[model samples]
Target: MCRLSGTKSKKEMIRVVRTPEGEVVIDDTGRKAGRGVYLCRRLSCLEKAYKEHRLERSLKTDVAAEIYEKLRHALL
Candidate 1:
């Protein structure tokens, strides 16, 4: 589910993962080895997650803006 919008449906959401090594990346395959968070597959949800620092809180680490940009590109 999207942390911000509360949207459900795995197929309609994107998974972002924070690896044990502390690297944050989008998990396109959904089988990555790490703690993961889900967000609605929309720019608004992405922006909300970034702006509110929800991703950082959920992953228990800092999330760089560049990673969000990369996610945007992948979603597009």
Candidate 2:
């Protein structure tokens, strides 16, 4: 489900995760061991999540700027 839009979408979504060792990463395989949050693939969803700190709130950790950078690149 998208944390921002609150939708269970069939469209591809970005999976951001905070690992057990406190590392935040994009879980391309969707099997990473950690707390994870989903966002819609649209740039709008990413931007809203970034600006509103929604991802950080959901993951319970500080998300890095580079993570958003990577997500933006992926969305493109």
Candidate 3:
């Protein structure tokens, strides 16, 4: 599900995770360890999550802008 928009389909969302080492990354295989957050495949959703600090709240850590840039590059 998309944590930002509340979209409830796994196939339509991408998983972003914060590793135990405190690195935030895109979880392509969905098997990474650590806290995870979901966002819709759209760039808007990613932006919304970034702008609102939703991912930070969900992962309980500070999210860097580079992470969102990486997501934009990967998703778009």
- Whole-model lDDT, model 2: 0.86
lDDT ranking, high to low: 2, 1, 3
Q: What local distance difference test score does each model get? A: 0.84, 0.86, 0.82
TM-score of 2: 0.87
Clashes of each: 0, 0, 0
List TM-scores for all candidates, in order.
0.84, 0.87, 0.82
Error of 1 at 4 (Å): 8.2
Which residue pairs show collisions in model 2? Answer: none
For model 3, the superposed segments whose C-alpha errors exceed 4 Å read 1-8
Off by over 4 Å in 1: 1-7
Which model scores highest in TM-score?
2
Better of 1 and 3 by lDDT: 1
Q: Per-residue lDDT tens digits of candidate 2, residues 1-76? A: 3554645553468789999999999999888999998888889888888889998999999999999999999999
Minimal lDDT window, size 10, model 3: 1-10
Per-residue alpha-carbon lDDT of candidate 1 for residues 1-76, written as tens digits (9 for 90 to 100)? 3654544676578888999898999888888999998888778878888888999999999988898898788778
Top candidate by lDDT: 2
* TM accuracy, model 3: 0.82
